[model samples]
Structure formats: C-alpha cells, structure tokens
Target: MFRQATRLLVRPISRTGSRRFSTDLPVAETADESFVEAWKKVIPNIEPPKTPLSFMQPRPATPSSIPSKLTVNFVLPYASELSKKEVDMIIIPATTGQMGVLPGHVATIAELKPGVISVHEGNEVTKYFISSGFAFIHANSIADVIAIEAVPLDQIDSSSVQKGLAEFTQKVSSASTDLEKAEAQIGMDVHSALNSALTG
Candidate 1:
C-alpha cells in the first residue's frame, strides 16, 4: 500500500497543451498616450471642396419678399377719387370670369361685368357692386378698376332690382325686331346680375 501511494505521488501530470498561468511571470507596462493623439495619428488633415461663386452671391428677391399690399384706384367716369388705397386682395367679376388679384401678380387687363367687387384688407372685406368696367393689374402691385357705374353692396335695394329684372324680362319676351330683342336681352341680363349681386 505504501509503495502504491509513492508511485501515484511521483507520476507526471498529463497536459492537453492549451495554456498555463503563473503569478511570477513578467507583465509589460502600457505606453502613456491620449485618445486625441491616437485619433490624430490615425486620421490626416484634409480641406473641404470649394464652392462656386454664384452659390456665395446674395439671393434674388422672391415672391414672399415682395410687398403684400396692393395700391388700388377705383374710378368712375364722373369720379376718379378712390386712388392709392392699399388693400390686400381684390376680387373682381371680370368678363372672362371671377378673378382674385394679389400682390406680385403678373400684369393683366380684364374687362369687368355686372357683379360684385370685394376688397380685402386683413380680416375685413368691403364689397361693391359694379355695372361694367375694366381692371388693370400692374407688376408694381398697383391695380386700377375703371367702373362705369358702382355702388356699395349694402346701398342696393332688393325691391328695385326685382322690379328692374321683371320689366327687362317682359321687354325681352314682347320685343318684335331683332335689335329690340337684343337690347332687351342685354338689359335683362344686367338686371338679373344686379338682382343676384343684391341677394347674394
């Protein structure tokens, strides 16, 4: 039993040859260096690409930069007094159709019809009913409306418009000659438009 114990104690331990560790082994110290220095060593300095001269120039005036108010000149043959009135927008019943004009709009000339013209400034709107005219829109934010006949919308009487429309309609139906019928038809159209403007 003693001999067997001695043999077991003297036997060499078999190793799989993976790794071995000991407290007595020497360890090399790390060098003293900062992260910024390491980054600078890894990356080289490079200048950015040049930009074109046009890109550096001042930008041209845009639509939003233009003045929002429009100078209006509403006129009649007898009265050309409503001049240089600054308004935000103008809604006109043009011969082509109803059109809304704003600041910085392209220059145009439109013939007016018998309907309402709305002048807007901020939240408040002033309306006028015109018989016939022409409107000119300029590039300089100026608009001129030359009306043959114009009155405030509230000033128009509904009873008078109804009576006029009925009379013109009767004339249109009873006329004998073509010229008479044409004239009556025009009168009826104007009266009907006036009635609509008053009621609307």
Candidate 2:
C-alpha cells in the first residue's frame, strides 16, 4: 500500500472586491492543469452591442465651432420675458467661481453663489445680480438659472445700488489679500452698473 500527502488552503475576497489567493493545493488530486489553462483562456461571448459599460454607448466628438442656437435663463424677477436674441454667452456666479458658458456646451449642473451675472451678445454687454442658487446647462442650446433672489439691473433701486457700491469700495480698500480685493472691486463695478441702468 502507498500513502500520499496533500495540502489545501482557502482565501476570502479582498476589500476592493477582488478574490484573495489561496494556498496552492486542490481538493482533487486528478485535476488537469492543461484543462484549467484552457478554461482561463476562454471568455464569455459579449452581446453585439452594450456588453461592456465602456462599449455600451458611443461618445460624441468635440465640436469645432459654436452652435447657431443659444438659450439662457436669468434669476432676476421678470427675467423670463427678457429678449433672448441679444445673448450669445452668459457669465454665471458659480460656487467654485464664475462660469462662462458658450453655445454648444456639454450638459452640466452647477451650484452658484451670490454675485453678478453677465450676458454678452456681440459687442453689447448686460449685467444682473443674483443671490445664491443653482444653474443647469444642456447641449440643446438651453440654460436654466434658479436663484433664491434676483433683481435685474433696470429694476434695482438706485440708492440701494449706490450704497452697495460704496460698501464694496470700502471692503476692497480694507481687503488684506489680492483675491479679496479683486472680488470686492468686481462687486463695486457690478453694483455701479446696476445703479446706472436703474437711474438712467
């Protein structure tokens, strides 16, 4: 009679969802190594399309030029009735910073902060003030801006706008950092323009 010795081990899955290696021993002694190699080489047939996540969808190529159609939304009261013909691009006060969205932009959702929003169509520029909110932009030449509070330049009170500018100027003068000073200056300029638009 002859006696044989064998070793076996088991390993569990890893934290990253990968299987852990077990000790090098099989429960069955007659297992064929060549058969195991053949099985490893075989891959399950994938569907003609959408098999893998990467191949499930086709990616769009980058556009060479801006689209002809453009749409924009403003948070200011009565902004819905504003003319869309004079606006080609919008400058939004985003939470991270101001965002300039041009036509043919990819879809995106962003949080906005309280600051000035500007619109530029050709050489003409229009500005507005928006209190914190969110904005959404889509590839279909549409932009939506929703803010907690908004007042168009022409609708704001002149005295209040002047007061805001004066305060912004003082803040700019007292700012300790370049960033602070720059922000304050922008605020002052935006407020001034709002006042001009209102009182003019």
Candidate 3:
C-alpha cells in the first residue's frame, strides 16, 4: 500500500491537463518559471511549449474614472463588424436574460444564446442576430463580442425565418430519438429568435 501511494504521487503531471483551465477571467500568472527551468535542465535541446494563455495579450486594468462612451469590438469568423467603436450602450441577449452594458461596467464573460444584440448610439440603434458565441466585458469600458455566425437585422429574411420556425416546430413534435429531438429543439430556438428579432 505504501509503495502504490508513492508511485501515484511521483507520476508526471500531464501538460495537456494543465492547459485546460478556463480563460474567461484574467490569469495572474501566465507561466510557471520553475517548471520551465526544470524542463530545460532535463531536456536542454527542446524548449517547453507555451499555452494559449501565454499568447493572449494582457487586457487593460479597470479604470478609476468612468468614461462617457463604451468601446465595442464585435468580430465574426470572417469579418469584423465593430472595432473599438465607441457607442452609448449595448443590450446583449444573455442566457441569464437581456444584459445591458454601459461604460465602466464590471468585468464579465457571458455565453450568448441565439438572439438580437442591440447596439445603441444616442438616438440611433443598430441590431444584429447572433447564432451563438460569447461576450467578454472588460472593466475598462471595453466590450469584446465574438460569434459563430452573425447577420444584420435588415439582411435577414423574415419570410424564410417564419418558414423555418414552422418546419422546426413540426420536427420537434415528430422527432423519434432523443438526439433528434434536441437538434430539432435547437433549430426551433434559433428560428424563434430570428422571428422575434424581426417582429420585436
């Protein structure tokens, strides 16, 4: 029993497992210098691989004074819609509910669902329908939004959205398997959001 416990304790730590931590919040320590130094001593020819957190640029710290405008950076896979554009406010459809972000908002990372993101600039408001993605609100009046797929409000086809909603509604009822039902439900949810974005 003593020998088995010693073996378990002496086992090598997995580099893959060590890199699996969430990147939503800021990490105080980017790299373990002691571990790297040990690795260098063991294998002098090869350097240790850097993790994703190491490559990420450090964000600005929270400001003491609240700014008047909120800077937004909205990007998709293929295009960047808004890049450091200052806006009055942004209303995001978060899983918890509709979240309104203003200047100097507390730092938060939100998993976004299928819904309309309303970007308000004084009297003018621009809207976009996001399929799914995340929103990272920084403490220094900066909001970074990235989505899998995002379409402008006016660019979406309302008639096709209504048709898809009807199709998915029927699919949800007729689905035979659990996986099928879940997929159908997801389809229905997206269509529902699109329909609401158009009408609402």
Q: Order the candidates by TM-score, highest first — what do you get?
A: 3, 1, 2
Clashing residue pairs, candidate 3? none
- Flag regions of model 3 displaced more than 4 Å: 1-31, 34-53
Q: Report the lDDT tens digits of candidate 2 across residue range 95-168.
A: 78779988887878999766767788888777777666788886666777777767665567778878998999
Question: What tens digits encode model 1's per-residue C-alpha lDDT throughout 60-159?
Answer: 2234455869889999999874689999999999999999999887879999998999999999989988889899987678889999988888888889
Clashing pairs in 1: none
Question: Model 1: what TM-score?
Answer: 0.66
TM per candidate comes to: 0.66, 0.45, 0.75
User: How large an RMSD does model 2 have?
Assistant: 15.7
Candidate 3 lDDT over residue span 1-200, tens digit each:
33443344334544565542334343324234444555566656876656455676666767789999999999999999999999999999899999999998998999999999999999999999999999999989999999999988999988999999999999999999999999999999999999988998
Best by lDDT: 3
Note the clash tally of each candidate.
0, 0, 0
List the lowest-lDDT window of 10 residues for candidate 1: 23-32
What lDDT would candidate 1 get against the real structure?
Answer: 0.74
Query: In angstroms, how far off is 14's CA in candidate 3?
Result: 25
Best by TM-score: 3
lDDT of each: 0.74, 0.62, 0.84
Of 1 and 3, the candidate ahead on TM-score is 3
